[model samples]
Target: MAEEPLLMNFSLGNDAILVQPKFKGGRWRERRGLRKATGPTGVNTDSILERHSKRQKTGNSDGPTRSIDYQRRTGLRHGVISSLFSYNPKIQSVTDRAEQESTTLPSNAPLVDGIDTFTSLGLSPIIASHLLTKLDIKAPTAIQKTTISRLLSGDTDALIQAETGSGKTLAYLLPIVQRIVQISEQKSKNGNDTNYQIHRDSGLFAIILAPTRELSKQISVVLDSLLGCARWIVSGTVIGGEKRKSEKARLRKGLNILVATPGRLVDHLEHTEVLDVSNVRWLVLDEGDRLMELGFEDDIKKILDKLEQKKGKSGAISDLPSKRTTILCSATMKTNVHKLGEISLKDAIHIQAEADAQQLLQEPTTSTDPIFSAPAQLQQSYIVAPAKQRLVTLYAILKRSFSHKGSVMKAMIFFTCADSVNFHYEVFARKVGQQNTSQLSDSTPELPTQCHSSVLSSVNNPDIMLYKLYGNLTQQMRTATLKAFSRNPNPSILLCTDVASRGLDLPSMDLVIEYDPAFSAEEHLHRIGRTARAGRDGRAIVFLLPGPEELYIPTLKHGFKDKRVNGSLSEDILRKAFAPAIASQTRETWEDNATGWQLEIERWLQSDSKIADLARKAYVSHVRAYSTHVVPERHIFNVKELHLGHLAKAFALRDQPSNMGRGGKGDEGKQDTGKHKGRNRDRSRNPAASDIDNARNSAPDPKEAARQMRKALNAMNPASEFNIA
Candidate 1:
């Protein structure tokens, strides 16, 4: 690997990275109007029996059971169904009408009603100072300016549009926090006469519903501190990845304001019988648009119906009225949002703002950014590259003149799916090897000679910093990765799905790569916006494959220039093959000729090493571990627009994951990297490549790979389970 071009810019190390959520103290409230079902329907009865039977079957089965994975996915499928049915028929009709209709709302100009201070937006004087001093929030962004008065005036049923990093989080949170504080002060003055039965389930207080577990935790982290000591007892978050029993145990006592995701909260609501949501007052649908996009309309509805039923009860819950407040905050709310507003809000006020907005009181810096923001500090551009050549193009970017302006920089490569990220990671690994060998053979000394090239990357894979982040990450692990990326000794790269695209604060990310851009153009904008934040200059690079003809438009393509789309290279098969295709290359291309080459090979054969480790730990492992990269919709013949057809034919086998890749195959991969040797593993290592070369017996078939991989896997027969993707 060539030494990276060094550039001097922002100081890398600083105070502990404080990534405050953009939604802190913003006026967005929880999505409410949910009620629990009093009795089981036929569907429920069937589901219970089905789940019980599944539990019994998996309970005794010991060989690589998928019970844990099924637990979450089962709930998810149920959430999808329940949420779909919970959308009262009226709302569904409205949704249908809106989808059929085409009405474009003209974009609004910057707000004239902007406030210069938090106090001007009704925050307490001390809180205002904290905003300016602690958070560096000098004034209100357009969302905050438009929402503050309305949310506080009790017209909480509203929807606002603004992208992430536009200070939108605080827009909904400030008012929520203020309202909570005021409620605390009021409750202190009032006695215990306020009944628990009248404890305001629906219209009582506030609940914020984010789409994913990370978003919930991110929001809850901010709220915990902002709410201060007085309301300590009133809040926390409820998410699926955490211990369900424990999270519910805390809520057993009840809470003033609850922060939750649509699915997990529904799970708790279904199971927790002692819960009361009658008096819930404030309802916020933060990122409600995303919920709809993720097919959570039904999940949201189930939650709302459960709350609504509890609130609408006649005799026992007489005090808690159906009348309540709701606030909807979305970066770009469309017809669905408007319809959702009609159902959730009671004659709500509309506060439409530019989806591409500016910082509070900041002078417009540049107006020509192809994306929006009168002066987007980020340099936004896209490149048209075939799926096969994106790895080369990204390498070009890392080697380009840009990003050299900054000493420490990060790139968040956005893929439509996690498997795509893995694909790119493999592709880059192959490309880097080809480049290193080419450079070394041509007398590029500073760049590692072909000898050290493979090892250089193996030791420090720039792509290793590249992680797969999506909605599936367990809550604890996701938070840890975010914290590490936020403030790290060395610059890092995060290969993410839509999970990190919106609302979350990923600081100092200087570049963004749209590896496989999303189906939605709005999504492309949000994905590219991770960098060049807070008045700092940033850059965006996009790679496109021509087969994506289904989602393209001429106008959108014009946003970029200097279009560079390189084709697939016939390179060494280090990793990056989409299909496990056969590719041949000379051994010397990466052969280490440093003194006794035979001895080195012999040593590699004798002891433990990371090179030997790659087969079980890298792309091969990912393909088995997660049945990803293939979206079921792509293969479904019904949807003409989404159907890959011919391309789908080429990957037909990838559609259904085999048992080996899915179960036993993945467990074996896990055991490979589960431990690290105390000594330099390579100094005494055996390359599996040699085993294949020496195998006169049908070139070391699956049995051999499985045998070699057994310790890396918990299962003896590793090929039994497989993942096609």
Candidate 2:
């Protein structure tokens, strides 16, 4: 067989040397008998005897050359595998045991005792201090500590699986920045007199692709902050929401680091020809599973193809530094992730972050199910309410949540659809919005007769500054809403759909409320992950009707069973809160009030009264608006049974689940049966005349019923009293 050409990387010692296949044009000459010393910046050739002399001083006394011919024969494509790791037979296992074992270690456990500090990981002075001082990042996270060494070596590819909010963003970013800094320092050492600078027209050195635009922008923001002192390392974002022209201009001006969504990046590749990733040394796919899922496959493939073609063309140039190192990160490993790895990555070292040691020994199998394990610091709970009373319950809960404590709370409220988001936003803004707006005449303002209008005149506790974020909003509006909510220090509630779920980082977020149950467990996990980030404590409450409470919630809990290897329990924080709240007369009052409101609402729908007609029309209009997102007249009460298994896995409950059999599905029928049995037993024992007398006495008076109905209505909406006119 013809010998492979040597593309040596000397940092791994004398036994290690990277091999590149012979080019078609034979531009790369083979030195069969020669030995040479090479650095990351460039290679320097030496005669055999001179190489021996240099090796002797370095204490790497001339060792036998280990053949890495497997790289050429193994059918590996664009991504390059390092020879240093190839020699280890155990690590060569496709289902890597060591990697899995490493993930099972306690999250706080140091990978290596001495190298726990940032500087110890070889980060430059500027970057290290920034992490410690500006970001207040004291030590590397579990994933970071385990993956940083291989990444900084510039030869290893990594597949990292860590929990959401485990600081995966910084894990990859730190190493990439360190490598760039290392290269610049090496350039200065190699007689380059120019200052460390990134050229606008020059090809990109790093590209990080994320699944969502929010994540893309977030990564860009983090990059900007990390490179705060290193101003010369230019970065930019290319995502769907922004203008194509602006992105093209930014690319035309050149960037050292590009954080982008796959689709938009491919658009520039196909249309503009402005981006040059030929020199990209690091490629990161954030949320790798989602990136390769249904919508993203083609665009991701095109981007990878473009990179491969660029690298292949550049391969003939012997002076090129190294092949791009690909890092694929996902919160949960789905079946397609493995396929994506095989297609896009080389022989990569896998790193899984887990809290259980037993999980490390088992081989990972790909599945459609999501892995569910939330941080222990996160407190999970739920509120059980009827469909009609949900809004009433929500208002009560919000009022209590805000008033119960003196501290300000930042909450992210999630719903199922955009229309739901819009309707809720309108209701809450009209009803619960603070009466702090410039008062009419700043004195005795004329109170509107309508209950909804009259409520604006009442000044009490600061009302929640409600903000809406959904798919229907324009890009500008969406960005503005997020910015305003994130920046505001006052108590605020951000009503959104899944658009806020995946990767947006909201600072100081104290709570997450799932106003609508998520479609799956994974969605729930990601939604809750919006809070309790980076070792901070946060609370998450999901609202479910009895039907969902029995069927879906338990299924959600079961989803976490396998993933929670450490044997932690999912303690429902709401048990205490629920007990106290249920004990209050307010609970009974609200239920009665809700029933009356529903009856009134229905009656108003058919009535000719002007006040009733206005409310009925408003309610119908809202429902119609919501229907555009899906089937018309579909009530939010109905929770679908789709993807239950997948959602169960993502739910990540640590508690023993309740029995979900006959009593679990629905209980209203069973209760009704018992009620009839009791009535029959009573009738059998009583005489006919006595039974009749008892029935007459038991029946409520029409006058009393009417009085109760009026009282309930007045309690629900104080403005209804004035609307009577």
lDDT of 1 at 338: 65
lDDT of 2 by residue, 640-699 (tens): 522222122111111111322111111221312342332222122223312332332343
Q: Could you give me the TM-score of model 1 versus the true structure?
A: 0.55
Candidate 2 C-alpha error for residue 351, in Å: 1.2
Number of backbone collisions per candidate: 74, 10
| Deviating ranges (above 4 Å) for candidate 1 | 1-116, 187-204, 229-233, 312-322, 354-375, 386-388, 401-408, 423-466, 471-473, 532-536, 546-725
Score each candidate by Cα lDDT.
Answer: 0.46, 0.54
State in Å the error of residue 501, model 1: 2.5
Query: lDDT tens digits, residues 1-725, model 1?
Result: 89999998867555445332221110112111111221223112233324434533433433223323332333311221111111111111001111121122212213332234566667777566666666555666655666776677764466665544555566788887776555544554565543322232323266788866666777887777665533343676776567777876767766767888766777777888755666666678887666655435656787788778877453332322246677787655455566566667776666633343333223333322223321233444445433223333355455332223344357787754444444344333323435522222212222211121132133233322433455434455556667766765455667677778766767777778775555455566667656655445566655533444323333234223222222222121112221122223212111111112222322332243332233223333232222212132233112232322212111111112223222212223342232222111221122332222123123235345334332222221111111011
